[model samples]
Target chain A: MNEKIRHLREQMKRLNLEGMIVSNPISIRYLTNIQAEGTLLITRKENIFITYAMYMEDVNSTLTINDEVIVVDIKNISKDEFENFFLFCENVGFEEGYVTYAEYKKIYQRYKVNNLVETEGIVEKQRIIKDNIEIENIKKACEITDNCFSHLLTFIKKDMTEKQVANEIERYFKENEADGLAFETVVAFGENSSKPHWIPSDRKINSGEPILIDMGCKYNGYCSDMTRTIFLGCILEEYKPYYDAVLKNEILSLDQIKDGVVVKKATEIIDENLKRNNINLIHALGHGVGMEIHEAPIIHTNVESYFKENMVIAIEPAVYFPSNYGIRIEDTVVVTKNGCIPLTKSDKNYIVI
Target chain B: MNEKIRHLREQMKRLNLEGMIVSNPISIRYLTNIQAEGTLLITRKENIFITYAMYMEDVNSTLTINDEVIVVDIKNISKDEFENFFLFCENVGFEEGYVTYAEYKKIYQRYKVNNLVETEGIVEKQRIIKDNIEIENIKKACEITDNCFSHLLTFIKKDMTEKQVANEIERYFKENEADGLAFETVVAFGENSSKPHWIPSDRKINSGEPILIDMGCKYNGYCSDMTRTIFLGCILEEYKPYYDAVLKNEILSLDQIKDGVVVKKATEIIDENLKRNNINLIHALGHGVGMEIHEAPIIHTNVESYFKENMVIAIEPAVYFPSNYGIRIEDTVVVTKNGCIPLTKSDKNYIVI
Candidate 1:
């Protein structure tokens, strides 16, 4: 069996769960490496994947004998077979976070298990600390992202539309061996940058205005996220202090991220620094990045948790002035024993394009 | 109140629900035109949208006095306030398909309502029939998609990779005033086309091979989906029959799409025709396309439903030969009283580039 599945089984045993149904595609991929539309069943003695006929070939091609996964086509499976998969199991687990209420009812009727319990995010918690191969893929994705940012510095020009700039970044990532974008590229120019989750519009870049580009790409199923706020021609005098404070806080936050560091404490430090500058941290300080751009160990003042080594996360510090402009600097980094190693090595200093 | 919300309230009356929670963002956008992270509550006397502080500005800006949606910051609302949102209501409806089991529990505890009943997809079923504005947006999107296909014919070269072609299509849409892709462009070269949902890879195009491109784009929150399988140089003798049969069935299926036409009958006709050619239809014939690429009134043999007027749908007929190549032709159309009007008008005739 794969190391991930073995680890998952151990966790299942600890939870007293005799069987589990992993329906979230990301979790399925994490366990079996089968990127198909299917439901993964972890019974007492078997790891089975049920999919439609269309995906059977892809699932078969992705799995091997060592994976210990049996692929069954949904068209060929009978209701009795589904009910019998976990026949003698005492308790079955389901992803409460992903499974819809209606689906919960349907699964209850179909599986006919004694008790269907929430898995308590057992797979997701395990995913917080990525394996070695996961780190390598994320590192490669970050390298490509940095290169794309470099290309954008030269490609971006005054009067160019934000959508155009966003498109170019996507094209650059695709041409540079990226699987795809981790999320939609956010290219906010001038006053539009004030919104934390601004969608790229036809707003044109103007001289002496801030341009925030929050972008990421996927490489080998791992994700890399980075955001850089730059100036079109020259930085405005009033914006200089805000940019300096944001950069300072970003660095302070990254410096505090290490093994055994409290997630909330690190975020509090950044929040305090921002507060000193008369700015508030609007969103979470950052979030863990892996197969999904946003995952476990959310760096927020409300999350009571600790950072663990091998966990890759994005740390972003920002200052947003409503209807004016925003300055945010972010980087994807890997948590280390002492500190954290920044994977996205883009220049944070003020740059005039 | 907006027509969409008014229609929803009427449906709520029929379901014997006094209050409802609309958590799906797409449904919320359809009702209030607010494209932000929020939960919409349809109370007896008010339309309330509760969102986080970050989305307050965007949501407020998108909504107006006529939208009648009162935006509230989640931070300002207390637990008691949450419990009062659906107060004095005997039954409150929820989107069972969208809300997860955990969220269902959370809402149940928070709302403090007498009964939480499924809305039975009241909003989604209403969305099946596109309004005038929605149809206009879908038509515009389809126009751009057709133009994109035209551009690809001239731009695609012998050695261009599948990813390159997919990127170019995306760039074309972005440059031409698209809201972005409705879904990821599926570009399969030669043998890769056998898989219906093949992700574009590094596979390069070759002479005398099939190039299947299934692409779409969003315009004004509406979607357009189309697929075309073209020959790079020449259609092989064995593949011509499959292409011709798929094209014939695609047209036959589209011709049968009209107001009040039985959905299952339309799909059954296509299936029977494909069976005569010794080919099996592996997937649904098509799906309704509006705000989402795939929506209600799924064109399948199992669905006991009827096509309604102004319902936008995609009719796709395909033939796949595993380990070889596949041919599929699709188009988005609007069902009318007598027949259907094709939105995507890309030529189905075999083209050798």
Candidate 2:
């Protein structure tokens, strides 16, 4: 049996669930190495993967017979057979955070369980702590992302449109053996950088203005996220202090974070430091990263959570002046007992390219 | 008032809903034309868009004072203020097909309405019929896709990996001013073409083997989908008949589709013809395409829906021999009063690259 599934079963036992339905494709991929369209069912006796005929061939090629997970084709199985898979189960669990109410009603009718309970993101909580293999994959993804950023430093020139720069970053990831982009590359020049989630446009990059490139890549199903605000030719005099304050507070927040530290406290430390410099950390300080770009334990003023060891997180500290320019410095890091070590090893010093 | 929101409000009135919460980003984009992170709330008297401070700038730039939707920064709003937005509403509506159970619970607690009724995809149903602007956007997207296919005929060669071919297709789309790909490009060589959703791999193409390229592009938020199967040198003797039958049925299915025709009847006609040739139509014959690559009014044997005027859909006919090879012909079309007009004008005749 897979260790992750076994751990999930133990959690299920605590909840008194006789069966659990995992429908989220990300969770399905995390549990089973089968990266295909399928739903995983953990009944009282066995683990079955239900997929259509089109995916059976790929699933067979991916999983061996020795694997404990049983593959069942939905096309081959009758409706009665599917319903009977959980006939005796008294308590069933579903991912309420993922499944819609319509799908929930469908599962309730199909399984005919006495009690359909919410898992309350048990699988997501389990995924917060990165295992050795996951850490390795994330490290590889970060390394590739770092390399791509370094290449962009040399490739990005004055008067180039943000879209062209974003396209080149994506092309670099593909050529450098990344699975693909983790999310859309955000390339905002000058005032456009004020919007944290600004989509790259056809605006030309000019000298003496801030250019923010927030990008990441995926490798082996794991994701890496990082952001850096770079100056094209020279940093503006008025923006220099803002960039310095952001960088200083970014390092300060990094120093405050460690295993067992409250997430809110760490974020507040950064928020307060920026406040002293007349800057506001508008967004969350950081977020856990794994197969998904944004995941568990959001580090913000309101979230009351503690840092855990081996959890990979992207720490982004940004200060926006609103319609003028914004500065953000980010890095992906892994939590240790005492502190977190940065997985993204790119230089964070002021770069005037 | 915005026309889309006005239409939604009229539907809400019939459902006895005083307010509606729209969380799906696609639906939000369709209604507000603001492509940012937020939730759209349609109350009894006004439309409000709640987003974070970071996105307020982008949201403001996208929408104007003349727009009916009022942008509210979530940070500035108090918890009581948010809850009061729907305080007086007797009945609230939610997208049961899109919102998760957790989100449903949150809405229930916050709104404090007498009844939280399921909308049953009222917004999506309204989105099915393409307006003049949407049709224009889809047509432009299809034009780019057709041009990309034409360019690939000259670019693809023997010994080229499937990933390379897919990458070149993507590059062509970007260079030709497309926003991005509608979905991941599927490029399969030889036997790999048997799977409908095969991910592009590093498998090298060889002479005399068929290559299947299913790709689409997004232009101005609308999507266009198209698929073409080409031979590198010559079609195999065993695969020739399968290709010819798929092509013939594809055109037949296209001819059968028109405004006011039942979707299933159109699909069944092609299915019966392919059945006579000892071929099975494994997947849905086609699907509506607009803002999304796959949308409403699925054309399959089970769907009991009628084609509507101005509805853009992708008509695809595929025949797959397990572990052997497959051929698929697809095009995006707009339903007319008498017949459907093809938006994708790429040549579907057999091509020997």
User: lDDT tens digits, residues A1-353, model 2?
Assistant: 87888899999999899999999999988888888888899999999999987678779888755558989988888878878888898888999999998898898887777889999998999999999999999999999999998998899998999998998988889988899999998999999998888889889999998999999999999999999988988987888888889888877777789999988888888888889999877778889999999999798989888998999999998888778888999999999987889999888889999
- Candidate 2: TM-score of chain A is 0.97
Instruction: Let me know the TM-score candidate 2 reaches against the reference structure.
Output: 0.94
Score residue A206 of candidate 2 by CA lDDT: 90
Q: After superposition, how far is residue B158 of candidate 2 from its true place, in Å?
A: 2.7
State the DockQ of every prediction: 0.88, 0.82
Backbone clashes in model 1, listed as residue pairs: none
Inter-residue clash pairs, candidate 2: none
The TM-score of the first chain in every model comes to: 0.98, 0.97
Question: What is the Å distance of residue B186 in model 1 from its true position?
Answer: 2.4
lDDT of 2 by residue, B1-353 (tens): 87888888998899889999998999999998998888999988889999987678779999866668899998888878877888888888888999898888998887667788889998899999989999999999999999998899999987999999998989899889798899999999989999898899999999988899999999999999999999998877887788889889888876888888988888889999999999888888889999999999888999888988999999998888767788999999999887789999999888999
In model 2, state the lDDT of residue B167.
88
Candidate 1 chain B: 10-residue stretch with minimal lDDT:
B52-61
Identify the runs in model 1 with alpha carbons over 4 angstroms from their true place.
B237-241
